[model samples]
Target: MRGNIIVRIEHDCQDLPPERRSDLVTRRLRFLSDAEILDLASRRERQYPGRNLHPVSITLPADVLERLQRLQGSRWSVSALIDRILTDSGKA
Candidate 1:
């Protein structure tokens, strides 16, 4: 659950005193429990489909990059599409 939700909350009230913190906060939340926590527990695999998945950097020739762009889908992410192609070709 902790890994699924990565929150980076920034606030300007840190410099202010404790009594004045709430006055400048944008909003507040109070809940007994959240349904999202339960959903996250069941959503591990869908988050990352396979093992050894990580980022890489490479320089492809302009012609090759342009050709790969044609196969990229509008909805599918560029990296995911490339990964599928590489996996199918047994290169990954």
Candidate 2:
């Protein structure tokens, strides 16, 4: 039961001064235990594989960039979108 609902995090807070270290460590641990963190981590692991892909550079109009950044929220990167377009267009 504890395994599902509780998360244990081990950190070395030794460098932090004794007066504030425990509070800092507690906050950090609470952040780790958050549902949002777990969900994001799990989603990221499933989405990306553990290999480096070659990088390609592309330029975008400022308006285009702004629009895409707005539409896709935080999931869109200009480079990724350019690569996706190039691939779909049989140019990659």
Pairs that collide in candidate 1 are none
Q: Which run of 10 residues does model 2 get worst, by summed lDDT?
A: 1-10
Q: Please report the TM-score between candidate 2 and the true structure.
A: 0.36
Candidate lDDT scores, in order, read 0.30, 0.33
Q: Write the per-residue lDDT of candidate 1 for residues 1-92, one digit (tens) a residue.
A: 01111112222223344333221111111111223212221222345444444443333434434433443334334344333333333334
- The residue-by-residue lDDT of candidate 2 on 5-90, one tens digit each, is 11111222234343343233233334443343233323122254553454332233343333334423444333343333333333
Q: Please identify model 2 stretches exceeding 4 Å from their true place.
A: 1-50, 71-79
The true-versus-predicted C-alpha distance at residue 16 of model 1, in Å, is 53
Q: How far is candidate 1 from the true structure (C-alpha RMSD, Å)?
A: 21.7
- TM-score for each of the candidates: 0.33, 0.36
Range of the 10 consecutive residues with the lowest summed lDDT in candidate 1? 23-32
**Residue 42, candidate 2: C-alpha displacement in angstroms:** 15
Best by lDDT: 2
